[model samples]
Target: MTSVVEHDTSDQFSPATSPAPEATSEPAGRDGDGRAARSRVPALRTFLATAALVACAAAGGTYVVTQRLADAAFVSLEDAVLTADALPVGSTGAGVVTEVLVTEQARVAAGQELARVRLAEDPAQATRGPRTETLKAPMPGTVSRIDIAVGGVAGAGEPIITMYDHTELSFEAKATEEQLRDLRLGMAARVTGPGLGRPVSATLDHVKPRVGADPLLDAPLTEEQKVAHERLTVVLVPGTGDVDAVSALVPGLRYTAEVDTRTAVGRIPAVNSAG
Candidate 1:
């Protein structure tokens, strides 16, 4: 019994060793995910580039079409100016300018006293005393010029002052024969210039044939050629009772006029050139 107990005691006392763990696949899975994310980036960039190109192309095409349409429907003139009738203020008879009540460029109302004139004494009958006559404004306007000064002699019916009515302003322009053919009386127009808050809406009031010298023609033009190439004067008046437009206008101020050719008002009839 003693010999049997001694056998295998060392093996029984030894501790047990555990098995090794299996290799993990998590690192490989992360590598695959990284590759997938990198592959998607180029595709997203390509899509954005394509969208941008399409937008730019559309915008360019739209601009070209819009410009062509505008060119077809409008006629423009750059040599335009604000114009009005010049009202003359005159003295009734020959006299000496005694006093000037208003200065040049001053605004005067209708029938306002503008100046005083002393009548000249008759040479044959020296009995009459010096008569002073007060001159009045003919209409409400801005005084543009003062022709007579104090102590100056004025002739009968002489213009002592010149004025302009601001309310009756007009847009005037000179156009060639070809350009005038595209426009007609009563056509709609727009005038724009510096200090004008917005484009003033207007209507073509007059289209008159005006005699003009063509300085560009170095050689004398034939009578027939002159008749064919005669220039025209176009006048446009702003909308009636438009105080803002009238107030914004100044005489001799430059402006641009755009005439709408698409409107039916005063449309020119087409003529056949064929014989």
Candidate 2:
């Protein structure tokens, strides 16, 4: 009777067996690779952003450099020609020129005798002899032209010789109104041309009051054209140097002038000192 009752006691008393846990479904290395690729996306984005920033900075730097260079002063070269101040020498009294002492292109000093004029003898007073007078150069210069020849009669105060002062040598240049704005008195200049053994030094001296078309033009022009062609005349005097050397450059010789526009700015200090 006890054996029959013990039938299902083992099933009730034995420890219950838990069902085995289900296996997780996943691909090999897929999760790690996906995590790695996702992490690298942020780094790649950061690198691209940094490169853009650098490119922007370089472009900005280049623009700033170009602006500075554009503001710097520049040397300007202009066409010019050598010229001089002229002085006329004339006879003080009316008479016939008997002897000519100086010829054209000859250099003379102040008060130097240039010619001798003999006054006509008075017929009413036969006893009076012809009065001889000497003509003298008014200033030191070179004879540029001769008006009267030997034995030619000249009137009183008539200019017989045209002379150019050796000390008044200058260079004349023509420029537009805009170009003249950059020039000023006392600015340094360098001149060069044919037969000029070396570059000559000069200084800006004068700016003429009149502004008009070139006086040497041969053709006529309309008013509008003339206004367009108007230019200012600039005069430059010789700088400190040998006077004879400067005088060697004759008038009407073509030359070029390099004008320094740095007078207002870009001047070097007299000395560079550190305290």
Candidate 3:
């Protein structure tokens, strides 16, 4: 309790001379544990994003494939109309139809007499040269039309008998500009005529460039145009044998044709144009 000693004022200790250490802890992302925790969030996000992207791509691919499957495919037609124009027995000149022997729908043999063209001269046209009429056979087919009458004048090469081998015909299918590519000279074909619902196997005889030539093929477009009105015609001959199928096929029967399709066989997918 007794004595007090006073120190010099200039010798006092200042707060700056004894500064305290900074109080800092490790930051959230500084250590390996912190870094690992942070990395997990981004990895999860990436997985979710990738899954979503894959799903979207799969949907798009499916849509494209479905659309292509529904596109139009190539079809082969075989149904056709059986028709024939009877041809004259001979290459005889023009003559008068003196004796008409065969009637319409009359079945005639190969050498049966069809009509007798008269050589008798007309009293009015006696000044003209002598007429030479001769006997002719009806085309060896069931007579369908009898256009000429007795004593009627017949022109040269006139179709008195319309004859065609429709029992079984070989069609030379004409191709359109679109279906003209990649076709072999003897590609397989399928045919189906009227009265037959089934498809018949056939061969592609040939693909004619043009449907047919009018009187003016070599001439310019003005005289005649061979513009295709419908799908190009493809000729197909039925597979060998079995005349019974064609025997029932009456002439003038409407038939459908398939160049390479047989309904008996399943419908084929169209070839991809991309490849």
Candidate 4:
């Protein structure tokens, strides 16, 4: 009877123990699971470090390429100026700059209109109103100056186009009279000096005498009234085919003009006005 009573008491307590608070507890999930958190830290650190290294490598490559490009080949100039002067395109009539056909520093083709002039001043008596046509370039060249602005009135004979001559320019290099005989009117020469290079394929245009010797070249040249001159001027034709390639040798690019006296430069048809 005693054993039976003890067994019955144990069975009744089992139901309460199954639903106790101690039955469910998760400390690892709540208190920052140690192994899981630590493993993620190493992976995040590796990703950040890899990204930094990749960025640094890209920057280094860019630096090397830029430096090499700067050191590469190109022509250099010194103390050069445009040979041509401000050329007038409009007729001798007072007019307003009505239309701007081109922009400053713009490249113009042969026979391209640069601007349109409309006569602002009326004549007391006229056979016909002032003749107007869009000003066109006689030869291909760059616009060096824009003297008149839009709506600005210009007097008679005012220059409309300050067209720098784009045709083959004769480079006037002063060399000794001894060099004059050495250079024939049609002989080939190399012209390279302080402001020229590669002997810009040159021809002895005509060994003309200069008015006076360069004072800088000869200090005593300025002292004499009857200035003694002994210098040969040269005309050069570019070897490049087109105006674009020729433009690479921009105006006022003073290079070392090396004269290859033996090499003869061919005459361009455009220079003779046949083209």
Candidate 5:
């Protein structure tokens, strides 16, 4: 037994060897494919982000252009004045004013006595007393101006008072012929002034051709006169809203008017022709 153990001693003294581990190719390949897919995700996200930014920029540009076009379609006139129906009170015969029954800014009705006048005594007819006459308003209106005082001599056809119909309110403006071409009846408008707390809605009533030269010009004619001479008188009436506010405005008050040409563009043939 001792001799048999000695025979395997040299083999036992050598190093012991174990089997090698197997390579995991399948898991490595799967991990490589997953990494490739993850790398593509960032590129796809970047592409989508770029596309969205471009769309937003395009939409903004379109809105700006549309706004500019809308603004360009409108026309504005700054030289506008409020006006009303005016009637002048005049004497028929030469006389002296004896008494003034109506005061300034007094509301009166038709046939209401405003003043009394005494005719000059005739030297030829000594027995006749001074002929007295009473002056009455021809129409219903407010007394705007009183030109004669008590005991003041008034000639025939001389104006003693001026009355205005406040109910008939209108806005008058002057525009060049070229500008008038773009305007039409029934077009929407907005009137603004220092007296008006907010813009008053209005509509175009008339566009009349001005006769003779331009009344607004005081200086000599220049190159500007040629184009400005043929002006159109534009009249605008209050809309369906509170017209009382517009009527309260004093005549001759300055205001700015903005005409909405958008609706008039297609509805009115003249506007299209001008364009």
Candidate 6:
């Protein structure tokens, strides 16, 4: 059975080739969609930018309105100064200053000796030598001024040194009677000035009873107007725990003050009482 096997050599002779994938043409809308998306990018960015600008403008307008309302709620003082409760250190007795232990602006502790004085010899007294008197600081404070130098004569009860307590710092401002009516004790205040790092928070402390002639009243006026031109002093102390504001302030430094007169402190109480 060795019969000749007629193998299909024709199939083997045929070239091995595949039908080219039917020429895939992208959807006609695909290119148009891509171009449309690319064109929209700039418009989208521009829309976003316009939206952001509108939001910023609204915020700026709101801020301006808020600032105006805040200003309306306050009583302003153009002339204000940082100050403290001052103490005059005086000579205990008439004497000539023999030694000065401290200079101006010196920090002194309570009962610290500031100077020594040689008392004048009393002719009535049997003492042969002049008594030496020691001048001491009455409180812990900074020496503001030295009125007498070594060898200068100081009278009894005369101020030899002027000092102020730093812890008692306050802003002193001049206001008229009408402005005083709007203010109350414990009202909040804001202080701004050249030396301050930022606006300081304070509290209205008191209104000094003494009225002084207004230094700014330079224009000629009738006697009645002059009488009405008296200026009143208002004091504001630093808010509690604001030590940085107090430390940054130096006494006698000029500043501007704004007192919040619309606070509920005085108004609520008055309304309740009336009701």
For each candidate, give its TM-score against the true structure.
Answer: 0.72, 0.61, 0.48, 0.48, 0.70, 0.68
Tens digits of per-residue lDDT for model 4, 1-275: 45544345665577765665664457856556777789899999999999999998889988988776543321122222224444666645788888877876677888998888887546674767665656788878878677787788877768776767655544544444444333334544334544343345544454334454356564544534322343334444444433233343445545433343333335322122211
Q: What TM value does model 3 have?
A: 0.48
Q: lDDT-based ranking, best first?
A: 5, 6, 1, 2, 4, 3
Full-model lDDT for every candidate: 0.77, 0.73, 0.54, 0.55, 0.80, 0.78
Q: Show where candidate 2 strays beyond 4 Å.
A: 1-79, 120-127, 211-229, 264-275
Answer with 2 or 4, whichever has the higher TM-score.
2
TM-score leaderboard ranking: 1, 5, 6, 2, 3, 4
Best by lDDT: 5
86-165: candidate 6 lDDT, tens digit per residue: 79877777999899899877878999998888888888884787899888988888888888888899999887778888
Candidate 5's C-alpha runs over 4 A off are 1-56, 123-126, 212-220, 240-242, 264-275
Tens digit per residue, CA lDDT, model 1, 85-169: 8887777778999898998768789999998998887676688777788989888888877899899999878977778887788
Give one digit per residue, the lDDT tens place, for model 3 in 149-260. 7767767666555444435555444444456443333455555655676766665544333335453536555422445432355555566763446545666555555443
Error of 1 at 233 (Å): 1.3
Off by over 4 Å in 6: 1-63, 211-228, 267-275
* Model 6: colliding residue pairs: none
lDDT of 1 at 131: 77
Which residue pairs in model 5 clash with each other?
none
What is the model-wide C-alpha lDDT for candidate 4?
0.55
Looking at model 1, residue 50 earns an lDDT score of: 97
User: 1-275, model 2: which lDDT tens digit per residue?
Assistant: 45554466665566664445676657547887899999999999999999999999999999988876544443344668778877776666678988889998788999999888887766886697888888788778888778888889988878777789877888888766666656666678778888778888887776666545465386888886775456656777777784567786578887888777766343322111100
Model 2: per-residue Cα lDDT at residue 83: 83
lDDT per residue (tens digit) for residues 135-206 in model 5: 999888888888899989998878888889877888988776667777777788899997898999988777
